[model samples]
Target chain A: MSDVSAHPSLSGYEVPIDSWTQPFWDATATRKLVLPRCADCDRFRWPPGPFCPGCHSQRVEWVPAGDGQIYSFTIITKGDGDQHQVFVPALIEFPEAGGLRLVAAIVETPLAAVRIGARVELSWSHAANATVPVFKIVTL
Target chain B: MKHESAIAGVGATPYYFRGQSAPQTLYEMICKAILAAVEDAGLTIRDVDGLAFYSMGFDSGLIAESLGIPELTFASTVSGTGGGSAGVLDLAAMAVETGRAKTVICVGACQQLQIRYGTAFSHMPVTPEKAWERAAGLTGPGQVFALIARRHMHTYGTRREAFAEVVISSRLYAATRESAIRRRPLSIDEYMAAPMLADPLCRLDFTLETDGAVAFVVTSGERARDLKRRPVYIAASAHGGTCEWGRAFHWLNMPDPIFTTAGSEPIAARLYAAAGIGPKEIDVALIYDHFSPLVIMQLEDYGFCHRGEGGAFVESGAIRINGSIPVNPHGGHLSEAYIIGMTHIREAVEQLRGEAVNQIEGAQFALVTGGPAPIPMSGAILRN
Candidate 1:
């Protein structure tokens, strides 16, 4: 029952929560950004799967995600219609998370200011069902 | 089974802009294309025993029943979208060579009226993999591939000028053909003026949203000799992806090499090995042109040039009609029509038969590729 209607900008975007992804949405609801880390291999699995891709380890633990840098970014100028607002989506790479790159929208920053390797800090936005994790560029 | 099977005929419907094919349903277009292909081969629907398709398969039962297919021996479809376009041809070839079926037909059709491919991913049930993408406002393929395009530009200095060459070159070829949708000559100025949909990707960078269908007939080499057209022998076919290319455009976690590549290196190696010829021997190339930059990336992945040299390769005017290797002579998906990657195959067969509208003189071989999308991205080599 994950909803994005609360965020008017993401009006039609809906993220359905299933058993495998329930824990992830639950953590985000508390305004915490957590990723699934393999207890046996000490590696992180993105999208929160049941087992590790490297070691096939089922032992998983929720760990706090640290700050990340922009690996790639895109400015979406054309969308569904002319009334659609332009937005920037970036792939934020976390060094501490074993080279994990997560998809996050770059908000609160000028579009032209976004670049690869720029540091980004974790932030949250309210959805109808969960808190979606977003990122803001770190100026300092 | 290299060279054991060959393409006997190819056919397609008039490509129309989205919603322009209103009165004609997708199934009707598919049926018409199949009939045209059968007629082109001098055969009837009763002669067809197997059907090979990609994506959703289009309900082969309904197709067989409606088309009055006397008996259906084999029916199968490759997974994923256009990436399996050439792979489906391989399936038909295998069925022919193994004595499972004598003649097989491969088909693909697209109608964007009910569902649009641009924002298709957003409408799907949010799987674990798509949850983050949906939240990040990454809704379409053009927006998603922009990330990869930007990375290529950052790491290798691949410029928009090279992408413009790909679009302009394809349009230039399309302008000469009567069956093509965009038959107007495109200049670099027009490409430069095109509105940017996704950063580094302009309107011309995207493949057209078309309503059309394409079909081709396949049979064993021995049986093809008695057919109506010149036999374009299937020399080799390969389809698969590397481990790092998982979910591809959806997941941006790939490391260096595969990250910047079209993920066609593995497919290319297998194709050349099985065909017993390298890229230089190919007279014409029908590389998939879903996006302008991908054409450059594939030119590298397929060994047309050294890695990261694709930008320079296109800028040198090598992919034009009189260049080293003419690519997409039928205008490809960029300027012709987007029936997935089937149009590339139709163009390949036409080139090998020496019957293409913009025919490459003495075209002995043609290379056709499937999507750079996901695993099992396929390619096939056909020789006259």
Candidate 2:
């Protein structure tokens, strides 16, 4: 059985962790964002795939995705008043990471101000022994 | 090119909330429907050689074993796409046409009433890339459709009242069917006053979660001719998909991105071409209504009307039972049990066979469509 009550604060929310995804959460604890990179094709991937989508090679390694540019985003004018009211879900793509994109919420910016192609950097927060990775606008 | 196969028989367990003392498991519901469908066609469970069902279904091995078949040849499980019903229709047609199987059974079952009530994502597989999207609290299927409803209203001046007409009309028809989950007649005023789930989208605009299963048996037309029940030929079927997850910034990147009129255009075009029939030839329709905006999108996509005119078309009450072409005469997902749109296909078969509880007179041709999710979509035209 899974530990349901241990994460009481996240009650009514899903706490997802799997064998392949544990390292990702570990990196987040140190406020770092990491993704699986294909050693053969030298491309980055999200969602911790066992093989590279670019070359379909099983030899892939996890690496840091230092920063990314927003490919697209939505302000989400309506939400259920949990994370929806405060978060701006954006699709961020890393140019140096071979167009690998991740869907993350942008912090420290008004929902209306979030736009496509916006520069952003990775940030992390701790929750129930797990670090949640998020994004914020890059300060130039 | 080979011709598509025919739907030999269709069946369903009584649709009810999961906790209604039904004493039924998901596998049991599937078995009941499969057995009933075989009986309806004057065939035996032993005749089934292959199966196609939703990936979300509870159990496949048990369903197969319960039927006590000697050997199984073909099996496919699908996820993603709200059009589970249309997917089965396509698969059934392919199964028979390819000689892969003599009789293929397609099934869909959901136990939403038994699952703990919180949100739909609770059951969804959460991957690292999807963490941020889920973390922002994007919850159920209705919520995703709600976003498109807002954009549709903003772009086409679609009034809330116009959207409510879909519910009001569907509920009015559903009331005639005793098996429908929501049979009470819904007036425009009551629809407007219903509790809101999403702004501009009221509770009435969403489908209810009920424990149920629907199944169909497909075979070659030559075989269907000798069956006990009327043979509803699978005239045409098609499917399409779009890459809109990363292109959401563009307002046009909403649910159905490929054909601009929603994915309905390609599916409908291919279906009509295969069947040698146009939208006007259809006598009944069962468009998937996970949300009401899709009804409007499908109306335009299926060539029932021009783009941007679906709001007016729905408001005209032309989709009612007595209208030119009755749509969702069984209340649809908005008022009927949400069975991943499989019930819609079952309803079409019933209409064609002249056996629906809320049967429309002389429904020789029926059109059914898939959902507006980012996944692959499908549509079918069934004729008696």
Candidate 3:
């Protein structure tokens, strides 16, 4: 992976970190993609919301998602090279985590083989004091 | 719902870069379009009581203040579908049916061309999940839609030639449209040779970003009867979303995820049912073409063709200006400019009014749609 400082410039403004998403970043540092799974509904949620989208349950807990399947992905061939270095992004759905779908990059597969539904395992890269959780193909 | 509203007026700022001579503020664009639309309707700004705009547009209070409208009655902002233009129909329906407000103005504007350029994912709210997605460099619309294009090719026997057909047809329509940013006609060979943005998706397959604003003023059919222009009635409007966001253990499990059944099966059914017309009755269409493949996908979803036959149907010259169904007569986002599909709606209204730069003769009905992915799909049917 390229250096964080070497990344391409972003548009508009960059948001500062808050407490709700802090744990998510901490888990990413360990290469684990964690989501707030509503203990009541047993479903992983997004936007780090206080309540679940399914049942609007307030009781939510951080859950570990070790593996997932590639729900959808795109291999960007154009753009800043450092930013598009064989970049393969996918929506990984974690069934164990109550079907929480998280967007991440698949680092281990060739671009051509990265199709919809490819099984991927969690991986991590440290960046700017944060561990960014990525995914890699689950090799047989 | 009384089911009686008409788009009385429409307006826009000539497309240009955000900071290029024209005003850069969304408020300025909204005012320009709204004033023009109101004037076109032979009405004054005072006639507008309610307002609906894209969530990404300028603030409602700011716009109302700028327009100097006192005691505004209704206001709303909607987003997520990228089809922010469809808000015109929704707001119009509210104004006419529920009597929320008599005259409603709907506006969509983006200064993206003036703003720093970045991937679509960059615009996603900066949460840990988004940050993780961005850190891995999976941050753009091109990449997301490319996956869809590839999948369509794999599952439906779609070919690059079929994809090229869309580019060629859109360009053909755009060539006659002076407002189109790309006036040059594109051939199949040229489209095929265009540089790839992603595997199977070429540069020509993507829409261009141009700075501009489009607006519409909608009111009750009774009010429209007194307007300057022939009022285009809103026959039907619908939006849908689906959450495969986390569903199955496999990637294909999320295949064909649709957010709005209105833009999908239900919307198509209801639109035809409400309009008392079918896809065959559509004289002109302004399907969003953020990506070429999506145009085909929406064509199928809207019942222009059967499942998995959109590619083949488009290849048959049926989407040409003089063909069975004229689509994107204003060049669409592919050739004209990408204003988050707002311009497509404007083009639909213009075609229905026989005022399009590339006007389709006697076009009575037009169908316009929003984006395909990331959920929240919306659509509208306009008739003169």
Candidate 4:
């Protein structure tokens, strides 16, 4: 994983943390990325669901999330009329997690530095009520 | 699902820019559209027995009471956003085919006075799913789809000009219609000059935020024959997508091919099978154009051309008003008004009935698609 310096403070915003996703949010406080893994099927679920789509099992555990590859991305030159702020949101795919991908911001990276196949490791962005898992570019 | 169900009439209130239709409430627009559709079908409002709607359908009981629809028998709504626009027709058709109702009204309405669609997602009360997206500063459909557009360019070496062609083609078609909000065609240079909302998607690429209502009258083929005008036969109608495309742009978990594509290939296949026709048989295509790149992607998904060849196909002027496929000849959501995917259906009905402004000579078949959304993205085929 990249250093915290590469992760920007996104503290002003608040992300709704529900019981189903509370564990994921709790793990993020320590800058640790955890995803729900089906205890029976051993498949990881993104967005932390109640049951497995494949095995339809309710038994699950939160395991440390692995690094991902940037599947695709976009740079927002402007958002909400905030002309000065630029956002780089990318779809990061975790191959080990049953190929489940998550939408995260590519923080502290120059717009020119992001590429489709770049490898990315988990990072943290602090929201008002929870710590959100973001990502930073890393060497393959 | 077959020629048993047909669209007897189509109608819409004037398309107005966001907030321009304020004096008229959403329900009022719905009433206007329903009444207009009833009259267009040469049937009195009393003849309508059922009401069908999609995308946050308003209360049917209220509408039935207000419009004084006599003896409402069937009232239902298809789920999902604009993705269910065309799917709602399936509900109406099913009701008519099953003899549950002789006449059904399929409607969609929007009034952007308070809630604007352009920045729609930003105002959403964050749920667990939205929490992940909102935290990443990903708001609005354009921002999310931009990632897919970027992947498409990366995967197929698609150029921005193809998207430009999509927009210009719609504008060219809209130029001939006084109903279109954007009638002036744009040059490639002008499109390139437009401000970027999201990288790879300029202002011109997104659909216009309009306030209006569009409605259609559907009935059994036997009854349609006795109506005022020619009936646009519902040869086929389909909704739903592959499991991989679940949640679509919002989740972005779909694998390669499915990720970059429009995610409509499966729906298109089912539609073709149900219609007993192929892509070549389609004379006009009213594809949903919420974003320009999706239009290109859908062209490929619908088999207008081979996969990954949509950019080139569109660039060759094959989607123009006089082109082989003649896509969006009534100006799609891009140049026409974006009443969700309702306008596209209206265009399909008009084209098939030989009443479209940019009419394709002897057009026999028309294809209309709902917006490229999550599971339940839909499409339909109509024949004259």
| TM-score for each candidate, following the candidate numbering | 0.95, 0.76, 0.83, 0.95
Residue B160 lDDT, candidate 3, scale 0-100: 85
Instruction: Kindly list the per-residue Cα lDDT of model 2 for residues B1-384, writing each as its tens digit.
Output: 236578888888888854662667667888888898888889998898888865454455777778797677878755654644587778767777888888988888776544632256556676554554565445555554555565566567778877888888888888888778888887788888876675556777777767788888899988888888878888887665544432222222233333234555767888899889898999999998877877887898898988877888888888988876788988888777777888899899888888887898988889998876555677888888
What is the DockQ (computed on Cα atoms) for candidate 2? Answer: 0.13
iRMSD of all candidate structures: 1.6, 6.2, 4.8, 1.8
lDDT of 3 by residue, B84-142 (tens): 45655765576568878888888777666435333555655755434544564655666
Q: Per-residue lDDT for A105-140 in model 1, tens only? A: 888676656889999887887655678888888887
TM-score of chain B of each: 0.98, 0.92, 0.91, 0.98
For residues B89-199, could you state the per-residue lDDT of candidate 4 as single tens digits?
888988988889999999998988877798888787878876778877777999899999999999898999999999999999999988899998799999999988888
What is the C-alpha lDDT profile of model 4 across A104-132, one tens digit per residue? 88887766668898998776777888878
Per-residue lDDT value at A98 in model 3: 58
Question: DockQ (Cα-based) per candidate?
Answer: 0.59, 0.13, 0.30, 0.63
List the pairs of residues colliding in candidate 1: none
RMSD of each: 3.4, 6.6, 4.8, 2.8
C-alpha lDDT of candidate 1 relative to the true structure: 0.86
True contacts reproduced, candidate 4: 0.77
Tell me how far candidate 2 lies from the true structure as C-alpha RMSD in angstroms. 6.6
lDDT of each prediction vs. the true structure? 0.86, 0.71, 0.70, 0.86
> A34, model 4: CA deviation in Å?
1.7
Candidate 3: stretches off by over 4 Å: A1-72, A78-84, A92-102, A108-122, A137-140, B1-3, B17-25, B64-67, B79-81, B116-120, B123-125, B240-263, B373-375
